[model samples]
Target: MKKFLRKNRMFLSMCAIVFLLLCTVRTMYKFSIRDYHVKTNKVLGYSPLERAMQVANYLTNLEMQKLQKEQERIDFKYCGGPCRFINVLYIREQETRAQLHVRHLAFTSAKVNRTLVLPNVSGSHLGACKSHDFEYYYDMEWTRQNKEYFNSIRMKDFVAWIRERKEANVPVSDQVLSTFDLDTHVDPSAVTHCFSGLTKPKSTFNQILKWNITGQTCELSIQAREIAMVQFLKGPSLGNGMNANEDIEVLHMEIYKANQWSQMAQSDIPIPYHPAVIKLADTTAKSLGPFVAIHWRMEASKNTNNMLPCAQHLISLLKRKKKFNFFLLTDYPHMFTQEQQEAAMKGVSSTSELSQWLQSNSDSFLMTDFTREHHEAIHYLYQHDTFHVLETEMERGGTPPDHWQIMQIPDRLKLADVDRPRMIDSGWLGILDKLIAMRSVHFFAGQKGDVCGRSKSTFTAQIIDARTIMRKSRTNYFGPKNKTL
Candidate 1:
């Protein structure tokens, strides 16, 4: 009987312990749910639970935006914060042609993001739903081993970097984004996904212009014109009492030396000299001391029938009296129409017409200038000037093939790959070609030709249009009465 009583006592004690465990678990779960609710209110005041209730009852039509307020609040651009934003920006765009169209919108948006501050200042190129062009690949990284610029970053590392930045500005304590349905929880004020389009920069930008940006996530379909400067201004905060409003004198003659247009690119990392340009310049100066470089802007601006006649007259006038050397730096002569080609042939021959012109005008002491460089140089070429034709095989005799060869060697390093865009039909070499022509005693352009610019460094050189020289008809406009090479 005593043994039975002891066993009953043990059974009772076991029941009491089990009851205590149940109560503890229930209490803990209630507090956990309460904390989650509080966090949600702090972030996005809208409750996912309320939205879910609406979803369960009916699919509210967009036609009734009054009832739309009853529907789920979705943000396509937010992409669950930074990690997803970067992934979509870099990775998802590579998936399909349709996706690339979206990428282009993002690229143009980023370019014009700064001008958004101007009220009523509108932007476009956003109406099209589909486009074949892509411009986001501007900042390329050349890989030594691969000999290419196809570079990428890891998602994990990207995520960490974004988290660090957002932590300072975003409040995670409140939002409760929706998940896949009945089987899930819905939160109108919470988001775990985001997107980007027409922004002024890449996803790597970490600086936040203002706090409270967490609840203000955007959608991917937002128009480029809709973007405001206040919506996205995330560069380094202005300090040192400097203001963005300060408009300093715009100077960019040696911009290549001061700022590199690359990610993490350092300023003024010593570049190497282009061997061909150097060799050509040195050889030309040695062979022909001083000469005039006349730029013929035909084809595009050779109209009013003044370009060819004016150029020929100027060459004849200069050769007859001054006995000056001359060189032709015109647009593509080979690409000229038959009528245009014939007119050009009358000016100077491939050493043939030039030799005859010199013989007839015996006193003409002339030679063309082709070499280019600087006074103080420890071997450095900022521009790829050696990548074009040394001389054109046009109407006037082409320059010496030994020195002024057309185009760089067949296998030289080309700037743009077959895939990348180089500013519509023109390449980096086109700019270099125009620049090379400008470095002469007298740089001439058509009545409406593009003159590039006269450098402050090229002190004694003069830039003039063909019409002005033809009108003046004298060596006086050639500049500085007593200048030497």
Candidate 2:
């Protein structure tokens, strides 16, 4: 073998060189796949509905990716100038989603540290959604929780803040915000088309690379780089990852920090109940001991006389065991506009039938009675809200409303002033109603959309109704109907 090697040394050296070259090529290929998740890539569509659903997950995954990249390149610091902050002002469009978006975006910012700032969202886009109320569940819960964050700056103040930073030689992100939509046209009807398997947005990191839309895009060249902020602003669900990455660990840590900073105290953002609401709840709890809290969704569907059946079932279930007070929190679809009610109920029984049944049901408490009782709460909330608004204004270096200005603010709120927090009173009232319902002993909820009802019932005052037991003891559920094994 030695003689043969000596004879073919030239051939052997050539073979070794080829082998090394092949190994290098293979390593490069593996890394390229690692840096860009090719398998997870897909086409993204331009639909508002898809946009809303995907935004949360997109932001979440983007933060995870960016955090990972930042850590990987931690020691590889660039000698670039002072990094900039691109404040992504929280805008309350459809306020429910808007609040969620704010929270999600904040979480992303915390993890990625691209220095994204969220401006306080002002104004509820009332009557904006096709399938919901004028001022659907926009509440003070988010703003109150993030009071410190919102108080940080205003629109003009933020602009000035960025300007000052720029002057002081601090890099401020020029590309503060970007929309995901490749094309601007949002055909409301096209959302349905996208879902019909006909179209889907191009959903890939490479696609984002193609578009070059992100905070880094403000600073870095739009070659072939992954910008975490851009990934968040756009993209569908982050393709499911198999192995948990270090980015996830950082994300969890950031989330913990964020929660610690923003979780509101019960007293700080109290359920906007009038003194009478507390009085009513206290009086009722004292007299009735413990009751059942059930939220009926009759307002969602006209044929949802399901509430009547559920109520009767509740009564039948509890009547024999104990005299249970039923705190029923429900929406009157009939109260909505004709289009809204129709959409909610989809040609169910007229409001009169449901109203008549509710009126006749001696066991039921009327929503109107609840409203009359909580009028003081509604009134008090306005004063509380106006006070906060003034405080915010004052914080922004603006004049606070004078005592007379506050006093002159009429007890009666109007549609004209709906732009402000006055319209939010209804949302506050709705939350109060839900909380009251949850204070019940045993809850009876409609079987359909069981998740919604079950979620509410979990807060019951054994508090564990069938639903709660199912949620907590459901693993024991399949085992036996027996409690004690």
Candidate 3:
């Protein structure tokens, strides 16, 4: 054995060293892997067990929250017993009328302790009617937070509640909605039943709460039904009808009065323009420094003859204020007007009279002056189509004649086929105009008189009221005197 050991000693020593080296390498590798995993776990702040526990806790909380929401929905729908709801019909004209209608109804609902079903604004045109969610135009979060001021639900939610109730075999009141069209010669006797025969008393409330159109005293009485709908068609009478003198605990309600219906509508609620609108308006207004806003409603002026004269007068008034830039908002198609077209044919500068006047007089801006990005933002919002046909039908008192045909068409195709005019020509563009005008240093709108040749416009009224609420200057350049300017 000693002889064999001596013969292979060198080889034996080499094998031992190699074996030790191999073992050391293996040990280092194992240590590195263990250290890496330990560090990773430390960074994550949790072991496998802790992670599993966290996941389980998250799932449990999610399920609990969902259950809580469902319970709340059930509570709201059932209302602890027989459910009572007051659904207001949408005023299918423009944003101003629709907004005012909802505001008045909200006040009435809060006063009578009924859940107000708010109508979604219609984005329909001459060809097709498309319903948009209330949040599309206004801040719904404000309404949710201001439940103390008024308890209201979206028209869609109300429709869903009604459907669920019907499916559950719960009895719903089929009482016909009391609708009044004040545009026609509505007898006081016909609408007096709505007030339960309450006469317009010689009270301070009566003096403040006069109807906008008829100049009659505004009054209302709560209906005695589980489900009641009151629709005031045409004008701001519905909004003016609310008892502004009612002793409400809401702090902002103090500013509410009959004449200042717009202020009341937005009082504590501050239902500002939609976030997208504000974003767009802010972008545009940032570029336009210290500009005056002019809203010229030439399309439907009470006195069409006054429109041209009014425009000339407005030009003169703006000329006097030479230092300020001008932002003109008009329904008139300046590019497509007869005068512009004729000028284009005659090899003259293809500009409308108003456009030429504005260009020659002051640095003027229009919706067309918006940048590509600004226009793109507007288009993006315009593409946000919401289908609330079921809700709309319910709110409108009955389904349309072509309901079945409309239902047959797919929602996407329906939206695509809808004849949505250009943003400049569309009624919805007025929303953007209003937002921009509200931010202006000065606002001038057409008024009802021979001097202005403009009709009484709710659009102008709303903008002025918004300016008032914003504590901006109320200086307007409407009349011939331009005294405010």
Candidate 4:
């Protein structure tokens, strides 16, 4: 009797524990489902799906809102965003070859979580569904579907979408986006399981701005465009109050359409309207032929008072025979105050308005000022009155070789954080080739935090024993006479 009672008690305890576990699991499931469901309410406090035909309809509306905001900020000639917006969505009419045609609508934030359908946009009226283009427009609504709106783009809006979800502490699973397309009918799931392929930048875009720092030292920044400014502002060092004058330089390259008549006449195969340009070997500064420009960005450091170590770097460049022209474009006189101006050139401000004025008027100079420490560089261009750099090349000569030789070389070489100048060869051709290929903006700093470092301390000089060498033939490759060695 005692043994039977003990067995019965053990079984009863086991049953009780299992029943408690079941209850806990049921409660957890209920909470998870509620969490996963879309909860944001519409104007009348309705759910997104409740107001839309499908999930995509709701998301497209979200995408449209984001695009409107982006469009408002785009200004290639002014704000200088990274890439320009190309209109993709359009309705087509005739299909001669019995082809199919499709059209896409822009999505926006104000219309997100709504349903959108086109009237008379069926296979019969649109001549079959062929292909479509998409973009998020942010504020517009569909002409047909008053009850629903378009959904935001799937992978294309990854950066914006992830940022919002992260802020709200929402757990957006990949399943939420697994079915959406990138832009056209192409699905994102074909490439990756994740909705966003975006990873953290190795160097944030905000670090590229010239004016974001607060350190009193002169600073310099180089960027491709104004969107680059936003990138720099978003960096980890943001709001650190480092007010250093900096240089923001951009190299602008562009393509131009050749005369259509010439293109049609010259081809066995139809020639493209624009072709990549190649430069010929020449010493003259003239444009050689029809071509476009490929822009680059580079930065230089400045002193605390917004002065440049020009003499030192120039001497080096001249001696080194570095290839490429050095055009000093800046807001020279206007950006600096009387005292600041005096300090820059020891109180001799001859070109008070040259830099800034040129920037405002020059094709090569953009709107930003490049004279101050916050915007200084050897090849820095804040603005350009003329983007026709290719024209300059065409008129100077068909084209100079992609690289030009600098006349002089620096005695020493300096890279960031290094104390002493390093020995480097002064072969102008080789250096030019490298610079053209890499198009990199380089900086050198000292342990004491001198941005450009003191020139004398940074330059490396070669000790030569003149007594040992024999005389050699001379050449003036870049001289007015164009003499050869």
Using TM-score, rank the candidates from best to worst.
3, 2, 1, 4
lDDT of 4 by residue, 1-485 (tens): 88887879988899999999999999999987776553434334666566675567768777777654554343222224322111111123211101111112122211121111211112211111211111111112222232232332222333343444344333222211111111223322222212233222122121111222223211322222223322322223335553221111111101010001111111111111001111211221232122111111212223423233432333343444333333221112112222333233342344554343233212223434344443342222222111112112111222222232122233333433236543322121222222222221211112122233222210100001111122211211111121111
Tens digits of per-residue lDDT for model 1, 194-296: 2122121222222221211222322212342133221232223368654332221100010001101122121111111134333434454334345454444
Model number with the top lDDT: 3
lDDT of 2 by residue, 1-485 (tens): 99999999999999999999999999999998875643334334336676576898899898878665553342133213233233432232323333333444444443334333333322322211122222233333444555544321223443444444434433222321223332333222212210112112222111121222224334453222224433433333546743222122111111101111222232122223333334433544454456555454333222322333333444444455345544444432112222322222333545564443223111123533322212222122223222111011111222222310111112223333145433223233333344444454555544434312222222222223323534532111011111111
TM-score of each: 0.30, 0.33, 0.50, 0.19
Question: Cα RMSDs of all predictions?
Answer: 19.8, 24.1, 24.2, 26.8
Native-referenced Cα lDDT, model 1: 0.28
lDDT of 4 at 171: 20
Per-residue CA lDDT of model 3 for 279-342, tens digit only, reads 7567666566787777765444343334434555566667666566666665433222233333
By lDDT, the candidates rank as: 3, 2, 1, 4
lDDT at 142, model 1: 17
lDDT of 1 at 172: 20
Comparison by lDDT, 3 against 4, better one: 3
Write the number of the candidate with greater TM-score, choosing between 1 and 2.
2
lDDT of 3: 0.46
Candidate 3 has its poorest 10 consecutive residues by lDDT at 248-257
Q: How many backbone clashes does candidate 2 have?
A: 15
* Candidate 2 regions with alpha-carbon error over 4 angstroms: 1-99, 114-230, 234-289, 299-308, 318-322, 333-424, 449-485
